[model samples]
Target chain A: MTALAPPRLPTILPLGLARGALELRRFFRSRETVVFTFALPTVLLVLLGSVFGDHAEAQGVTSSQVLAAGMIAAGIMSTTFVSLGTDIAGDRDDGTLKRLRGTPMPAAAYFIGKVVLVAVTTVAQIVVMLTVAVAMFDLSLPDTAGDWLTFAWVFALGVVGCSLLGIAISSLARTARSASAVTQLPYLALQFISGVFVNPITALPTGLVVTASFFPVKWMAQGFRSVFLPDSMAAYEPAGTWELDRVALVLGAWCVIGLVLCLTTFRWRRGQDG
Target chain B: MTDAAISVRGLRKRYRGSRRPAVDGVDLDVARGEVVALLGPNGAGKTTTVEILEGHRDRDDGEVAVLGTDPADGGRTWRARIGVVTQSATDLLELTPAEAVRHFARYYPDPRDPDEVLELVGLADAPRAVVKLSGGQRRRLDVALGIVGRPELLFLDEPTTGFDPQARRDFWRLVRALAAEGTTILLTTHYLEEAEVLADRLTVITDGVVVAEGSPATLAGRQSRPALVGWLEDGRPRTEATATPSALVAALGQHFGGEVPGLSVRRPSLEDVYLELLSAAAPEPALATAGGAR
Candidate 1:
C-alpha cells in the first residue's frame, strides 16, 4: 500500500492575525477590560484637565496641557503594561495558554497575536486621550509636520517598549489574583515619577527625576510634551530642551531590554520548573 | 504509518524535588483504530503519561512514539495529526461555540466543517455563548474542538468526569462514533464501568507501574476466577465460591425440583479484578490482601 501524505502546516501571519482579532473581540466584550483600558484614562484626563484648567505653570503653558501630554504616555502604560500583564497571567491561571501549547500553532504566533492586540489598543487609547484633550480642555493640536513625526515614532516605540515589558513582568504573577496586584505597584510608581500628575516636570525631586529617566515612561512623556508644547516651552524641561535624541535613545534601549527579558523569562505554564 | 498509534517502552518521569518518579518503567502500546483505557486512581500518573505523549510535558527517560514520531521532537506537522482534550476545561468565555471552533479550525490545514463538528458532538442547537453552556454542553464543545481538525489520534484525559449518567452515555456514543471513523483513542479514566464499556483493552497502573494489562474481561485473570453461588435457604443467606457454578445450580435444581430462591450466579466483575490488582500493587500489600479476602 502507498504511504499516507503528510499534513499541511499553517502559515504564521494569517493564523496570528486571526488569533489577534479574536482577542480584540474578547477585550471589547469584557466590561471590566473596557472600563480599565479606555474609560479610566479618559476619566483621569478630564478630571485632571478640569482641575488644572488653563493655569499656566511653566514656559507659558497651562497645567492641563502638560498633564494632557503626560497622560498620553500614562495611557499607553496602562493599556500595554497593566492591562496586558493581568490578561496574560489570567490566561495562564485558566489553562488557556496550556491548551494553545498542545496545538500546532507556533508560540511565536501566539506572541505576535498578543503584540497586535497591544498595538491596536495603544492606538485606540492615544486617539481617545488626544481627542478629549483638544476638544474638552482647549489643548492645541500639533501644528507642524515635524511635530506629527515626533508623535508617530514616540507612540510606536512606547507601545513596543511597554508591551514587551508587560509580557516579561507577567511571568512573576503565579495566579490571576496576584497579577493585578503585582503590576499595579510599578504602574503607579512610574506615573508619579514620570510627572504625569505634577504640574512642572522640574518640580519633582532631582533624584526622582533621574530615576524616572532610566525608564521608558519619562521619555514617552517628554516626547509627547515636545509635540504638544511650543518651542520656547522646551526651556522648562529637565534637560532645558525637548531632547528628542535622548528620548529616542532611552526608549530604544528599553525596547531591546524588554524584548530580551520576555524571550528569556516568559513562562507558558506555572510551576514548570524544568 | 506504524501499526501502533502509540508505543512506549520503559517510560519514566520524575518531578523535581520528589523522592519517587511519577511514572516508573511503564510500557504501553495502542494499535491503530483501537480504544485503550489507562485505568488508575488519583495520583496514579495517568495524566503525567498522557501529557508526555502529547508533548506538553517532558519525560525524563523513555522511548515514546506517537504516529511513528517521537513526541519529544515532534513538529507542527506531527502535532496536527494528534488532538488533545486536557483535563481542565478551557475558558473561552467571550466567544460563541461557533466562533471558537471556526477560529481553531484555521490553525489546521484540513478541518471538518465547524457546524458539522458541533452537530457530531451533540451540541448542534446549544446556546451560542460559551459561558452560558451547561457543564455537559461545555464538555461537548471541548470534544468538538479536539476532533474538528480530524486528527488521526485523540487523547482524552477523563473526558466525562462531571457528566451525568445520560450525558456520559451520549459522550460514549460520540467516542464510539469517532473510533468507528478510524480515530485511535487513548482515554484515561478512574471509573471502571466506563473503562469496561468503552475500551477494547485495559492497562491498570498503580504507584507509576503497570500491574496488569489485558481486555476488560481478562485483566488480572478476572475471567478465570470462580463465580459466587449465592442463595436463600430457610430464611438464611448462603454463599459458596466454586469454579463449577453451573454444576452446583444443576444440583440445587434437582433437589428443589424448581427454581432456587434468591439464587444469583455472580461472576467476578471488572471492578473486582481492578481492586484486586490495585491492592496487590499497594505499598502495604498485606493489609490490602487481608481487606480483599473479606
Candidate 2:
C-alpha cells in the first residue's frame, strides 16, 4: 500500500447529540423518574402557593405570585443541580461512565448531553410551573419585551451555573444511594437561605441573606421575582430595588466558580476502581 | 516492532491500603489476530490486568502497549481501534437493545449496522427495556455493544459470566467468527471448555502473576503429562501412570493372553491440567518465576 488515510476520530457534536437523545429517551421512559422525581417541585409549588396565595405582600402582589416565581427558580435547580448530582452518581455507579470512557467519545460530549437534557426538561418544567402559577395562583406573565428578555438570560445562566455545580458535587457522593441525601440537604437549606420560601426577603436575618447572596440561588430567585412581580414590589426587597446588575454579576461569577469546581472535582470513575 | 497486538512487561499494581499487590508482576502478549484466553480464580488479578491493558486503569509499574502505543497515552484514534466488554454488565435501563446499540454505534468512525449487530447477538427482537432482559440476553447485549465498533482488537473480561450453556455456545461461535475475520481478541473466562474451543492460546494467572501460558492443548504441559493405564487382572483392578501408554496397554493385553478385560487409557484433560496449575500456583506467590518475560 502506497499511502493509507489517517484514522478518523469521532467528533463531539454528533456524538453529543446522540448521547443527549439517549439520555432523554431513558429519562422519560421511566415513569417513576418522570412522575415522582421531576414532578416533585411542581407538587410542592402547588401546596405552598395554595396556603400563601391569600396573603397579599405588596401592591397587587399576593404572596402566592411571589412564591410561584420563586418556585420556578427552585424548579430549575431541581432539574439541574439536585437531579444531575443524583443521576450522574447513578451513572458512575452503574458503569455507564466507564463504558463511555472505553469508547472514543470525549468527556465533553457527555457534558453536552447533560446540558441538553437539563435544558429541555427544565423548559418543560418551567412551562408547567408557569401555567399553574398563572391559572391558579394569579401570577401574571411578563407583558414587556424587556421582562421576557430578563427571563431568558436568567433561565440560561441558572441552568448553566447549577448544572456545573451539580456535576462537581456529584463526586462528593460515595455512592448513588447517598447522592440524594447529600444534594437534598444543601438544596433544601439553599431554598430557605436564598429567600425562595420565606416571604418579604427581609424576614430572613440580614447576615444570612448576605451569606446566601454569594451563591447563585438567591440571585436566581431575586432575578425571577423581578421579572414576574410588579415594579413597585421591588421596594419590599432587602435592597429596596431589583439589583439586576448585581444578579447578573453574581450568577456570572458563580458560573465560572462552578466550572472550576467541576474541572477540579469531577470523577469519571470511582477512586476505588482498580 | 513485534507482532503483538497487546504487550505488557513485568506489570505490577498495588492499591493503596492493601497489604498485597493486586497485580504483582505479570507479562502477557496477544499477537495480531490471535484469540488468547486468560483463566484465573476469583480475585486472581485477571480483571486488574485486563483493565490496565484496556487503559481503564493505570498500572503502577509496567511498560504496557496496545496496538503499538502505551495504553496510558492512548488517544481517540488509538481507542477507535479497540473495544472492551467489561467484567460488570452495564445496562442502559430505559433503552431497548436496538436503541442502545445504535447509540453506542455512533462513537466509532465506522460501525456495523445496529440491526445486524442485534441479530448477530441474538437480540434482534429485544423490544423490552434492557432492565427486563434475562441474564444471558444482557450478556449478549454487552457483546453486541462491544463489537458494534468493529474494532481490530477486542478485550473481553469475563464476557460470559451470566450466559447459559446455549448462550455460551453461541458466544463461542461468535468468538470463532471474530477470530476468523482476523480480529485480535483477549478473553478472560472461567470456562475451560469455552477457552479450549475459542482460544488459539491460553494464559493462566494466579496471585497477580502468570502461572502458565501456552496453547490450550499443551498449557502447563497437559499434553506430555503421564497418562493413566488401567485393566482388570484376575477380577481385581490394576493401573499405572506412564509416559508410554500405548506400549504399556499393548504389553498388558499380551500378558492377559488375548485381551485386557475392561482396559481404559486416560490422559489429563484440560480441566485436570488447569486445576493442578491453579493449586500449584496458589501457594507462594513468590514461586512464580520470571526470567524471559520480556
Share of native interface contacts recovered by each model: 0.74, 0.72
| Candidate 1: tens digits of C-alpha lDDT, residues B1-294 | 489999999999999889989999999999999999999989899999999999888998999999999998999888888998987665898889889898888888788899999889878787578989988888888888888888999999999998899999999999999999999999999789999999999999888999999999899888899998998899899999899999999998888789999999998889988887777678475686567665
> Candidate 2, residues B214-280: lDDT per residue as tens digits?
9999998888899988888879998898999989988887898878898999998899899888867
TM-score of each: 0.94, 0.93
State the displacement of the C-alpha of residue B102, model 1, in Å, after optimal TM-score superposition: 0.9
Instruction: Return the interface RMSD of model 2.
Output: 1.5
Q: Give all candidates' CA lDDT scores.
A: 0.88, 0.88
- Alpha-carbon deviation at A108 in model 1, angstroms: 2.3
Cα shift from native, residue A237, model 2 (Å): 1.9
- Go through the candidates in order and give each one's DockQ: 0.65, 0.63
Task: Give the poorly placed runs of model 1, Cα more than 4 Å off.
Answer: A1-7, A272-274, B232-238, B250-261, B285-294
